[model samples]
Target: MDLERLYREDHTFFKVIVGDFNAKIGPRRTAEERHFGTHGVEWNEQGERLSKFIMTTHTIHGNSQFQKPSHLRWTWESPGGQFHLPDRRRCCSEVLHGIGPSSPPR
Candidate 1:
């Protein structure tokens, strides 16, 4: 399956995902409680898909709910003038427990 190729069971237990996710964590963590919170723009389809991806793979979205300034969270400005956080760093087990609902290391 396409998803199978996204992860590997080779000797590594930790993974750092970085790329153009083209998704937003959004401002509603109700359905995606652990991986998101109330911040950023409104949630969209990609965010919903990403929520499932993270949950299914035991991964945590880099947009932890620890509370940081909005400016630091965005990486680019949309042509429509919306700040877009199109990239993120997702992590999996062996190191997930130590994250403590905090933003990724600076």
Candidate 2:
């Protein structure tokens, strides 16, 4: 069976979806008051498609769920020195919401 078929059969078995989709997810706040802040985010064609898929499947953008600086957020730097985050991690809301940075030392 194809990966999608297997994935559907055992969705819980999936910890993450890893790949370089060359997709850009632009910033937006409160998707139906659900999604969080995405720094410098932009919605491209790929992002539109991904957003629709996320809405349908209740998937969360793993990277967006975190608080990272602009430099660390990108996966690639173009020859012209433009940075873009192409790699992505997709997981269900339950899994994504459960992750956050631990408290700092006093």
Candidate 3:
């Protein structure tokens, strides 16, 4: 029904999501804030509950299962103010981090 409910009820372990979500969330400590066009709305008490759910639910681990366990990789591509569609590959996220412009040029 809500973000807090979804993050709390449906998540068990390492629920990694990869997609184009145009909305931003909190605990606002992530890196997606430095850019422009980011819609930082009030998740409010519901958002806070959900944030807590995410923090408490996630389990940080260190194992030999994979190499390069980084959260993000830096690309030379700039944010916002662009030209073509086929050349684009990424979007802004609440958890995502970068110091660039907001939305690309249309």
Residues 18-94, model 3: lDDT tens digits: 33332234224555322211233334564444345445655211111224334442224446856466534465445
Identify the runs in model 3 with alpha carbons over 4 angstroms from their true place: 1-27, 30-39, 59-106
lDDT of each residue in 1-106, candidate 1, tens digit only: 3553667543478887766767776665466466655555656687778777777777767665566876676656578876755444653335444465575774
TM-score quality measure for candidate 3 = 0.24
Which stretches of candidate 1 lie above 4 Å from their native place?
Answer: 1-4, 8-11, 37-41, 71-106
4-30 per-residue lDDT for model 2 (tens digits):
455467748455766666667766656
> Which predicted model would earn the best lDDT?
1
Q: What lDDT is obtained when candidate 3 is compared to the true structure? A: 0.41
lDDT of each: 0.65, 0.60, 0.41
**Model 2 bad stretches (over 4 Å):** 1-7, 11-15, 33-36, 75-106
- The prediction achieving the highest TM-score against the true structure is 1
Model 3 residue 21 CA deviation (Å) reads: 16
Clashing pairs in 3: 31-97, 32-96, 36-102, 80-104, 81-104, 81-105
